[model samples]
Target: MHPHSPDESPAPRPAGSPRSIDPRRLRADDLRYLLAVSRTGRLVTAADALGVDHTTVSRRVAALEKSIGLRLIERGPDGWTLTEIGRAISDSARVIEEAIDRVVDTVEGQDSLSLHGTVRVSAPDGFGTAFATPALVRVRRHHPQLQVELITATRQLALRPSGFDLAVVIGVPAGSRLVTEHLTDYTLGLYACDDYLAKYGRPKSLAELREHPLIFYIESMLQVGDLDIERHLPGMTPAFSSTNVFAQLEATQQGAGIGVLPAFLTQRTQLRRLLPDEIDIRLPITLAVRREAVTHAAVRALWAALRQEVAERADELLLE
Candidate 1:
């Protein structure tokens, strides 16, 4: 693919342009522009992070590439993406940023270097509130300038994940480009409100449980294979369905039907677990990050905070 500089729509130069870069002419500081573009994936957003105008961001990045005699970034359908070499340069930029942060700490004392820029996180509704929220909030405590945006949804992750710096997904995807690791294992079990069981009569067995209506995700639209009800309960279908887990929970609370919900979600609710031995369905939650994004201080800190939260909340995730 031909690389297009985001700064300008230019006329093609003559063939055999020299690709050699002069080390003396290279401006190391301009690497900051490249790092900003890598983080935001657009000239305008990067400019916003740096407190500069979009055109100036473009100009500085262009100058940096010219000094190196290589195309570091190229425009794509959504925004700008880094080339292979550009990713390497971003790593170097991260090191420089770390050093700068260290220098700030030396000058101003510990926890003084406030990490700047926004870090976006994509997660499920329940996990977003229960786990990702508190963890990201702690990151803000350390680096007050860092911004965290959490997008909550229960759907399949995009093939080429763009806006978000981190993704917490339901299962380990088969063919995903992002770096993934097992975040935690959580169980889903049959749950019913006290009123529902009181009125409709509690089921003693799996067969009896299937007799009542079930409240769950819309089967047709559910992209998460791990949440498939059929895999856990054979010959069972949801009587009421919604795309959102919270909606399903609310429906279950209204005594609409029994819900197959995460154990963590029902902690404070009146929902009572049913047939724990027979109805428990365990699933894995995975954390994914872009290849180039892991180097950023904010991203690394976010993951670290998230991991610690999960570890500390082990009892909540997996009830004994």
Candidate 2:
């Protein structure tokens, strides 16, 4: 995500001019560009949302910073992030957006598609396809004009997040700007297919598991600290490592090795669960978004839909 920076810092106040910091100098129209940049993390994307160009987005935000006498944003490697004061300013800017929406609602009439525009979301592959998809579908059905983009990847939430409006992560993320909540707790277990066990011999105990080949995520590429193999199975390692959970499942199904996989994923498979009591691993799913995002109608709708989906289908997320 390339968030444009017209300058490393806000345009410096005119040298010793009588122009004091004044709220009246701030243009109400410019805040929309700042709000769009805050949500999209890229000048181009913000431009698309605002029906303007990237240069215009940069110029407007710079003007906002100058008027407010504070740096509204700083460029990070991934994108631009709001400064502490910038976030505070963003909070007020969100109120303006809400007021504008209210005005539009009064004029256009509150149609079902009043909540339009793209809401980008990110999640792990398995959960994105399984749990999140249902919620996304439900939201789309209600607001047919709303566009939801879900990018599936297993990684730590960014301290300075970009490229997505919302994210569902494996565990709680540590970020001052993020507002997070517990989504659900899901369980994982050691499992082997009938053919796999017949070929490699079933592990009767925890000690026996160490001697067999393990199927799980590749150590080097696995970024989610919660899925660390050593945390759950010390001294044991994956013989067949894969980035994709489905690949690990398939390898186990094809008699490759015992797999430490989510129970929800293996529920319909013929794989045999092993040492349910000793090897049961439970982890939490978390929902996160920047504080400024709460004002967005589409984002709020998607958030409610996801929470409702998880609560209603709680049975599907866990084995026992």
- Candidate closest to the true structure, highest lDDT: 2
> Cα deviation in Å at residue 286, candidate 2?
1.9
lDDT of 1 by residue, 123-179 (tens): 999999999999999989878767787989887765655556788999886434488
Best by TM-score: 2
RMSD of each: 4.0, 3.3
- Error (Å) of candidate 1 at residue 214 is 2.0
Clashing pairs in 2: none
Worst 10 residues of 1 by lDDT: 1-10
Q: On residues 104-214, what C-alpha lDDT tens digit does candidate 2 reach at each position? A: 767877763466667888999888888899999989987765778898988887887866778999988998768899999999999999987877788989899889999
Q: Against the true structure, what is each candidate's TM-score?
A: 0.78, 0.85
Off by over 4 Å in 2: 1-9, 13-25, 51-53, 66-69, 102-108
